[model samples]
Target chain A: MQVEGLSINLATIREQCGFAEAVDVCLKHGITAIAPWRDQVAAIGLDEAARIVHSNGLKLTGLCRGGFFPAADALGREKALDDNRRAIDEAAALGADCLVLVVGGLPDGSKDIDRARRMVEEGIAAVLPHARAAQVPLAIEPLHPMYAADRACVNTLGQALDICEALGAGVGVAIDVYHVWWDPDLAKQIARAGRMKAILAHHICDWLVPTKDMLTDRGMMGDGVIDLKGIRGMIEAAGFLGAQEVEIFSADNWWKRPAEEVIATCVERFRSCC
Target chain B: MQVEGLSINLATIREQCGFAEAVDVCLKHGITAIAPWRDQVAAIGLDEAARIVHSNGLKLTGLCRGGFFPAADALGREKALDDNRRAIDEAAALGADCLVLVVGGLPDGSKDIDRARRMVEEGIAAVLPHARAAQVPLAIEPLHPMYAADRACVNTLGQALDICEALGAGVGVAIDVYHVWWDPDLAKQIARAGRMKAILAHHICDWLVPTKDMLTDRGMMGDGVIDLKGIRGMIEAAGFLGAQEVEIFSADNWWKRPAEEVIATCVERFRSCC
Candidate 1:
């Protein structure tokens, strides 16, 4: 009953369980693959988290994040780079497929998105060597345009692929359905990414019709109007045969449910909708 | 002192005033140009609205909207087309520059964005002859990515331009700063639009950092983090010399203000930020 090529990003059950408990829930549901956020790993202590992950023979699809490059000052930028290096190390320790990056947005009190974008590229370049040294590929997750101003300025698969091309190897893209479902150039970009061999990860989540919040009102699969299976087909056709990581950040609804119920819903939705 | 090359989309003060009062406020502030929604026009009666525009020699920058093409059935599609024709007639009656189209998203209970997009294109195509006969150009306003699910599937300038190219003449794009500020391909697409002469309108609004609501949490020009002057410069450079229409949908903030105050602030923002 193992669900091969299916991974659960712990954020889906963030409100219901901690890192260890979330993993246990995933295991019980025959989902051996998982992606954990840095905070989740830190909560359990990275050493214990790594021990548990290793002992369970679980597939670490990806580490939750390692980017926030844009900053108001050079010192802040250096701090972000240092943090990214550490994130790469953590991903390496966990034997993750890649260190996914939610590249930072405009620095506080700044209006120049172009400058922020340049900072993102530079930050990625600065950390590329460290990531490569740790044998961890940096996966740039281009967030939805909604998050471009405050979360991640890298807002398109094409833009992320451009960054990957500029940085050469050791860099690629994390194709998240929630972030990119609206892209008019989606099929073209996926084809381009395939040609460049730059697709690193495929994350899944539904976009609610009435998305209540800008940050955390993510819909679980089958609950919203996303063509989840269609997007997966596109990603698969683009040469990424990796796990489809379910990563919902629903604060009001799904997050309040029990961990077992949440996992069960995810499994059912994965089978039916996705 | 009239602010040249600036227009106010009346939705900015929709919560405070009707069409006639809003027009009076704009005239008082020496902003001769305005774009009113269909509801606002209906409130005052189209004949009165047209008479006011003619008497005051006011410039109707563009009509608020005329698209929501996707439907659950053929009857819905036909109804949408008929409505679009009416919108075109209204725009022509007002002597507006174009009929702005906020192309509809997925049909109810459906996850097929591609089909929705096709419906939009087909809907526009169906209405093109009527628009042409009415002497009203159709301006496809690519809404923000957040609205792609329920409001609009066309979410980028390039995508809008593609539709324009396919549809031939009497069709173009409304480059809204709020919707497209985050697009990395913006400059390239604007330049491409210019080459094709597909740039019909330039809408302006700030994207607040913490956008509270997906539909109505738009920010005023200087209050938010958008590079208004920067984007305006891009559009101007791309040969679009139309009025920079201020279109904010701030339900909690600006909407609560006096209509005159909102118009005055829009004038000030246009001079300073834009």
Candidate 2:
């Protein structure tokens, strides 16, 4: 039977297959919803990728990403804006629900996070008009604080919501369980996001007790220490009923498995665990 | 000249020297403050440690730590409480300013962070009377979110303050730069902690761009991205003028250096960076 609410982010099977093959695997498992990274869409050519997505009637819950605003200089920042615009355009072309953003972090040799944060706001405002015109929402993914220095300056949902309120429109937040599961004010912030109508996507993954890696060592849903179902309940109560996109960057275990087997496990765990 | 308002957490060079040797190294550099771990103190005997501190008039900013409240069973939890009482007595014997609490994470194999946090509060409340009679304050060190699963559940100063508010007396927080430097509401929360008179200690260390190991790969001050002077300005503005305790858990780098060399570096970095 098709899992109605399950959406597979293409990165889960990116190593096993390319854009076309990953989609076929998801379809075989009856997961019609998917979120694809910009690279995956770019590799197969956006035209063919769009054709496959359209013909199959896939629900693009979100485009994998479109934010990395901080830079060392004006030229570097402009380059970032140019790339974000391209990502926004890709989301628009795919008819994706939103463009997920992993907003950038500190510039090289700089400890001024406050300045970096201001740059993020400025960069978002710069691309927001283009995103709005294309009718693609911007989803700010507040990564875990572990990533605050090198990956994202926006490290909390409340911080992201504050940005959303400041930006006013065409912007919201993506609440990923992996990135935000440890937040002390998670419940309060989820409710606050719902009230602001600022929750754009909900990503799911487990945080391993002995997480072996800082980057690509994500655990499969039921294999780690996250209360996934409880968080989903909070998200649902907060008014987001969108697909629960499974986004895992497990470099060793899942990446080496058969694409079909990984999808099957996700479906099983989503049913039993989440 | 003696370095006033500077303290060395012996763990900075734990791999190099024993407790007495470490204190000797600090004293050689005209450093008069130190925070030693329970194991280090036990290795040298508390009586000798106390005698050394009294002879030299050393300031014990804090006793290393004494909390791991979550356990799978009540017996396990009771065992933890027993250990904590002993830690309190030891801190009292040393006449340390406070007992730092790392607090524990989810009980083994459990995904329930909420339960772990509740256990932390209950454990503190249970131990508050003992700490009070012994005249030792309990400083809740809110660890970085990366350590949330295994080290601490309290990940923000605001959350730490919430627990302090609920617990009422003999409880505060250790604002470590490596842990809380990324908090979006850092300035606001520091001010709030100051208002509550719950700012027990202030620890200093840098957050490296590529933090290698989660537990032991901390950077020395002036070597990473934390805005030390800025944070110090905030702490001072918030009315906290305690020793800027140096706590580095560097396994490969600082740990391998000579004790005197490490102490000298700390002294130089503390004066220049912090």
Candidate 3:
């Protein structure tokens, strides 16, 4: 009864469950793969979290996030790098497949996105060696262009791949359907990621037609316009057979539902739609 | 004294004025250039609108807009093409420089963006003859990727240019700062557009950091993160010296203000920021 290719990014059920409870809920549903946020792991203590993950033989598809590289000053940039190093350590301890990086956007009151982009590249190159030493691959999660100003400047699969190619080893990309499904160059870039051997993780979620909130209003898989099956085919063709991690930041809808119901829906959608 | 290089997209003050009234406000502020929507022209009758434009000696930067090509069925697509033809005629009547095309997104219940894009191309091809005959240029306004599902599938300058190259002349691009500011490949593509002589209309608007709503909530010129002067410089360097048409769709902020104040602010911001 195991859910073969389905993994739950803990954020999908973070509203209803903590690290331990969320794992318990996933275990109840026969989903043995997960990607947990750093705060969720910290709340239960990394040791206990690691124990739970190891005891259940859970697959840590990825650690939720790590990068926010661009900063207004050098001290702030150094602080981000230090924080990223800690995140890498935590990912290594959790036996994660990769550490997902939502690279930061423009510095406060700054209008130059080009400069911010350069800082992201430099920050990644700086910490990449540590990530390599820790045996944890860094997955650059290219956020949608909507988030290009405040959240993450890297907004395309091809852009992320460029950074990956520049950094050489210990770096790749996390292909999330919600952020990239709208890209015209999606198929071409996905193929390019495959050829570069840089696709680390695949995340699944739907983009609602009337996306009410810019940050939170993500739809559950099969509820929105994304061609999940088609994208999966492209990813598979690109030679990435990893779990399709379900990550929904639905503040109004999914977050309001019971964790059990949410997991069940994800399971149902994985079978029927995705 | 006419505002030398500034133009007002009537939608900026849409909630405040009708077609004739909007033109009056623009003329009163010494803003002789304006872009009016099809509905606005229809409100006062096209003949009357044309009479006003000719009498006042106003420059019509573009007629807003014409493309919503992708549809659920063939009949729907034909209807869209027919509508676009009417829009072109409207632009011709207004003596507008170009008919801006906001190429439509996925059809209802459809998930294939590639197919939607093809429909957009075919839809443009269907209308090209009419547009050419009417002597109205087609400016494909590549909307932000956020609108790719429900508004426009053409979400990048490069993508729009590719379609223009395939279709040949009478079709170019409307470079909107709000849409393309986040693009990493923006500079390169703008240069390419220059090389192809494809830059038609240059639209100016800022992208708010915490963009509250996807459709509305657009920032006025100096109010947000977009480097207006920098982008304008790029456009100018790329051989486009068209008026920077001010287009804001803020349901809450600018729309609630008096049309005079909005026009004054646009004039001020165009001077200082852009």
Interface RMSD of each: 0.8, 0.9, 0.6
Per-residue lDDT of model 1, residues B1-274, tens digit only = 7778989999999889888888888988999999999999999999999999999999988998999999999999999999999999999999999999999999999988998999999999999999999989999999889999889999999889899999999999998889999888888999999998888899998988788888889988998899888888888898989899999999898999898888888888888888
lDDT of 2 by residue, A59-126 (tens): 99999888889999999999999999999999999999999999999999989999999999999999
lDDT of 2 by residue, B186-254 (tens): 999999999999999999989887988888889989999999999999999999998999999998889
Clashing pairs in 3: none
Q: Candidate 1 lDDT, tens digit per residue, A109-193?
A: 9999999999999999999989889899999999999899888999999899999999999999999999998888899999999
Off by over 4 Å in 2: none
Query: Where does candidate 1 stray beyond 4 Å?
Result: none
lDDT (Cα atoms) of all candidates against the true structure: 0.91, 0.93, 0.96
User: Which 10 consecutive residues of model 1 chain A have the lowest summed lDDT?
Assistant: A207-216
- DockQ for each numbered candidate: 0.87, 0.81, 0.92
Candidates' TM-scores? 0.98, 0.98, 0.99
- The A-chain TM-scores of all the candidates are 0.98, 0.99, 0.99
Assign candidate 2 its CAPRI class.
high
| Cα shift from native, residue B139, model 3 (Å) | 0.5
Per-residue lDDT, model 1, residue A169, is: 94
For model 1 the local lDDT of residue A193 reads 95
What local lDDT score does residue A255 receive in model 3, on the 0 to 100 scale? Answer: 95
lDDT of 2 at A142: 97
